[model samples]
Target: MTETATAPAGGLPEAVFDPERLAAVAASGLLDTPAEGTFDDLAELALAITGAQKAFFTVADGRRSFWKAAIGLDAGAVRENDIRDSPCHILIGTGLPLIAEDAVNDPRIRDLAAVGALGIGAWAGYPVVSPEGHVLGGFCVVDQDARPFTPGQTRALQTLARSVSSEIALRQALRQARAAGDASAALARTLQDSLLPPRLAEAPGMDAAAAHLAADATGEAGSNVVGDFYDLFHTRGKNWAAVMGDVCGKGVDAAKVTALARYTVRAEAGQHTHPSVVLHRLHQALAAQRVSDRYLTAALASFRPAADGVGVVGRYASAGHPPALIRRADGSVEELDAPGTLLHPDLPPAQDALKDTTFRLFPGDALLLYTDGITEARDRERGPLFGDARLARTLAATRGWDAARTVDHLRRAVREHSGGHAVDDTALMLLRVAGGPA
Candidate 1:
């Protein structure tokens, strides 16, 4: 339940509670449990310190009052009150301790037969609160005669109540952390489904397929979604464009930037003919956003259908990203060297030194582009990473397969190498030039 505190009267310190903290407190699985030895010890100590006939830990969960632990009282009998309607409700509502000298004479307690039945004429109670400032319950003491508690006794009980509050607060914090983790997982799943295309666009005289798999772990919820994206589209002139890249960082921020990069590449490819020029325009557009400490690593390739053979020409740029893999039809795999500095780096000269590389795709040749997540995945024992050499060997083994099958095999190999532990988000795109006599 949400609660707001009013300023204390007569210059006394005010008691405050936070609504969110209370929600978290309610989420803890500790409420309404049978009395245990640890709590009984606490109540016993409280009664001894306050010199009261009985002391108890009472929790009110909207419906009934439950005694989680009690001393000098029957555990079963303490469950008889509708605490929401009790005279003591005012004390809890105000988040202040209440002390009554004579319940028989005090109009507020006179009608409370439960207290008279127990032969109690005096009482004192302090509210227990979670760290986020939600009221969880109360710690209370009672006597059979009309008597005022000493200042020292009241202070001691207040201190003990604070201890109970701290316990509640700890439980609340754990619950909130778990909830946030669950929410982040759900968000990552949604982002992956919405951002990545289901299938690649078909190209004439060439075969292409792409697959993207985000790491199952590493975010606010233990799964980071990296800014990696890929796209395939056909231009007005019937030329096919395929692009793949990775953006810096991970999580929601990186995911947003990844989406922007994907669209930027597609839009520019539609407007520009040259793959190098399209990447240049994309860099300018992304740089214009003024994103702090952000940049993209990209590769753009165009394919045109030929009467005798398919022609594939591509230009790739790296902004602090790993190189791509090229697999020949003859079972040879090599890494393409595309050297460029990260965008928005601390040093302007390093950014200016960035350059692109152009390559021609021979018949039966394939190009593979991916995010660092695939290369940086750790082994089963969390030891060395699955480096580029392993990836090259895997690609070489699958060189004779179709583009779709090649991508599938590579994905399986990466998963196996990492022992199913994908610590970073990964994206992979494959383009194959069909074989025929020129």
Candidate 2:
């Protein structure tokens, strides 16, 4: 077959390759593929347009030369050659395709006996470059008889090469995205596990339990672990203190804040006798950081044993979180009205206040402290929130059970109400007042 140079009317600069572009192309993992229809079509089109006997696509990955697709060449003919001896390798380094009308007269290939032995006298090549300017490979046509390429044919090959480059870029981007997603998921799992205590601390005169559920559909696993956290600890005076709170956002930053808030409450509660005073201390500690935009909504409560006639007393304070639900032994549920403002000092005055409230815990009574994630959980069918009223009703229904049983029922109810899909992180602390202090 005759090899002819078909160039568009005007002479155009040849395609150039660069080291940065080569690196990007090398990363795509597209080289050395078995013939696919897409590449095969391009090869066949190249031969038809250039009127050459053979056409091929070659990718060079530093150490190896890979022929992705080829026409009119034996399958076994596709093999890696020494880069030092390959004239095409030199042309690639120059960032331009080599157009040789006669290999015997071309200085770059004249001394290369392989071209003469293969009966290849004419050659034309176009560099395949990625959008970011990486040279992935080259598309070329060859013939036994020498001829010149027309301008139109050269342009057609260049267009086809660009299409190949785009595919390479798309594949590379997808790989990067998947890798990022995997890393994020691993990080989320680690953060969630680290923030939660390995086991809940048992307290006398109270059956204490905590539950935290993270939304499954939010950002990448490690990208955003909702920052809701809860903890139960004993004070130096033997009273039991519990705190539940949610940081303002999800992800790593929020997790950091959640951890800080949790420890701040525990430390302050141990030093103070009243829950309100403990909460105030936590606010001040957080305020000192000057992170006014990053706030936490929390409930801090202390359970103290009562004297002769009086039952146990639960003193609690709220900072922008949902009010605590108290289930009395009489099968009634009361929403304790606490006074508090959101934790951020810079928030408007209307939102910066804190509320402190008290509740008398009779024998077998239970108290539930939770973040807004529970009440705001959406119902699957109606798209409305599960809401505080439903939470109250649920607690009332489960009031007959002990602390552990009540928490179990409440968790199930919340999950069901949200269609088994938690859209935010939910943290709950349940404290049951036993018949007498243990």
Candidate 3:
């Protein structure tokens, strides 16, 4: 029989804890996990169906209710709420649907957080049951104003709660579905795309070109996202900065570090004249926040336009990252002599290794910043890498090309080198000074 109750008939469900119910909640594994679009979509659907301003898919862990999915909550809202403060405290153990026609006056829950801090005047919820008949969590609808749930509406919501339970099951299976490459790869790619900038911004007096592609193009494994990333931004003092970096590993772990490094560098961009200063800031930030051995190497360069406007001068720093190269108007290639200290909390003296190199870019000179993935791409899965010499030749041949053409040319060359499949994550950024001698 379907269980429905407006309020607890007994003292309360949590005066005592049930081990079996808590175990089912733990097995669901929905607490404190990464937010996924699948859950967001379901929450959205729930909001529309109930015509409620907010909907939350949550699991109660005895002391607090953890929201796995929520819509209409502020960005800074805490995801967990104290059980004593929430009306859902009693809902957790009962396994019965709750419909408070006037929650603000409902003696059973009027003193809860739903009515006070949250200002929620009315609410309805359905138990989320697994196939084994364990109530894993509950789906809830909330409103700031008074409202009531009809019998038909409550039944519809019950069905949706079951869907949410199934989604949790699907995601758990997907996590363990590493042997099935396609599903995990799709999820990884979704996360990777979210971390990457959709497109590079256009910097004045420069032509910018950028590209990113997955390493496992053949889909032989899940987690195809790679460690390479690039950025172009206008900094303070009428200058522009170009950044290229590679995290130490691949997939989700590397992507996490990539996101941290990119945002930290961008945060310090406008304040520094030399790239080394920014790298130092990121080094300290990561050192204080990190618990693992993860680190990334970065190449940072700041460009200030010359008064003549015919070219620009670049001040660069390298932290164990690949050295950037310049292709002059006459097609000669020179690698900038930037210091190559790797950023790590383990090395206290490496900051001095961060030397700044200054170079003049006369009109028609192109600067190329890239991650090692490009030069190290293998033609076959286990073949020789496409090393530095080949990259030099490719740059020399592209001297006759523009900024965009140079990037396109390199992409084609890499494709040829890797036989159209990348053996590692790859990224490239090309910046050409606006003019070349006619």
> In order, what lDDT does every prediction score?
0.65, 0.67, 0.72
Residue-level lDDT for 258 in candidate 1? 56
Residue range with the least summed lDDT across 10 consecutive positions in model 2: 4-13
The TM-score that candidate 2 achieves is 0.54
Q: How well is each residue in 8-84 modelled by candidate 1, as lDDT tens digits?
A: 34321222234553454456455666777766776788888878898877765554556676677764564536653
lDDT-sorted candidate list, best first:
3, 2, 1
lDDT of 2 by residue, 251-347 (tens): 5556556555665565456556677776776666555434335777888888777766456776888877788888887668888767777676465
Q: What TM-score does candidate 3 get on C-alpha atoms?
A: 0.58
User: 1 or 3: which has the higher lDDT?
Assistant: 3
Scored against the true structure, residue 392 in model 1 reaches a CA lDDT of 89
Report the number of backbone clashes for model 1: 7
**Model 1 off-target regions past 4 Å?**
1-182, 218-221, 291-293, 306-310, 345-354, 436-438
Name the regions of candidate 2 deviating beyond 4 angstroms: 1-182, 218-223, 290-292, 345-352, 380-382, 436-438
User: Could you estimate the TM-score for every candidate?
Assistant: 0.53, 0.54, 0.58
